[model samples]
Target: ELKVEQNPLFLSMQEGKNYTIYCNYSTTSDRLYWYRQDPGKSLESLFVLLSNGAVKQEGRLMASLDTKARLSTLHITAAVHDLSATYFCAVDINNTDKLIFGTGTRLQVFP
Candidate 1:
């Protein structure tokens, strides 16, 4: 069975501060993906870490995956209130496209 765990289920930071969200899985996975969802809104794709040591960055957010350790991280740099949202990490088990998502990390940034 595949299980996913995320740390700091909720995060509150001041604008321009930095923080990181972690995701760990119990088994091997073919790919790791990240998503963001605003309150009561649909999810939006963020990054897809396809290999070990893979990293992707966009704007103020960056995501990396370490397959050997079954861990993925989403880092926020110079956070802003606009970036506030719920972030999730998902895994494609055995490349099956069946994604198991973490509980989610709700981030709130204040000025």
Candidate 2:
């Protein structure tokens, strides 16, 4: 068996920025997967590309993309810790209509 953990979400950034979205999975699998989510958008797949060298993304989680290179990396490894939380937006009805932050995480693990 392989140790596993789940965390939320993804982000887009320019240069001189850090990546907070962490990835974790077994290191001995024959295949791997990497996913991300953008604001105002749905889940997106960073995998499944066509050629090599051509790439995409907006954050420090950057890498080359080319199917020919078989180098279309999936980046399946833990970043820092084994757990993470993605905070969301919420309305604080008690603070005179103040705004607060919340976390809603959904983990999908296959056994």
Best of the candidates, TM-score: 1
Which candidate leads the pack in lDDT?
Answer: 1
The TM-score obtained by model 2 is 0.30
Each model's lDDT: 0.94, 0.33
Q: Which stretches of model 1 miss by more than 4 angstroms?
A: none
lDDT of 2 at 28: 26
TM-score of each: 0.98, 0.30
Pairs clashing within candidate 2 = 51-66, 51-67, 52-66
What's model 1's TM-score? 0.98
Task: Kindly report which residue pairs in candidate 1 clash with one another.
Answer: none
Candidate 2 — worst ten consecutive residues by lDDT sum?
82-91
lDDT of 2 by residue, 3-85 (tens): 32334544333333233333333322222234444445554544332233544443323433433322233232223221122
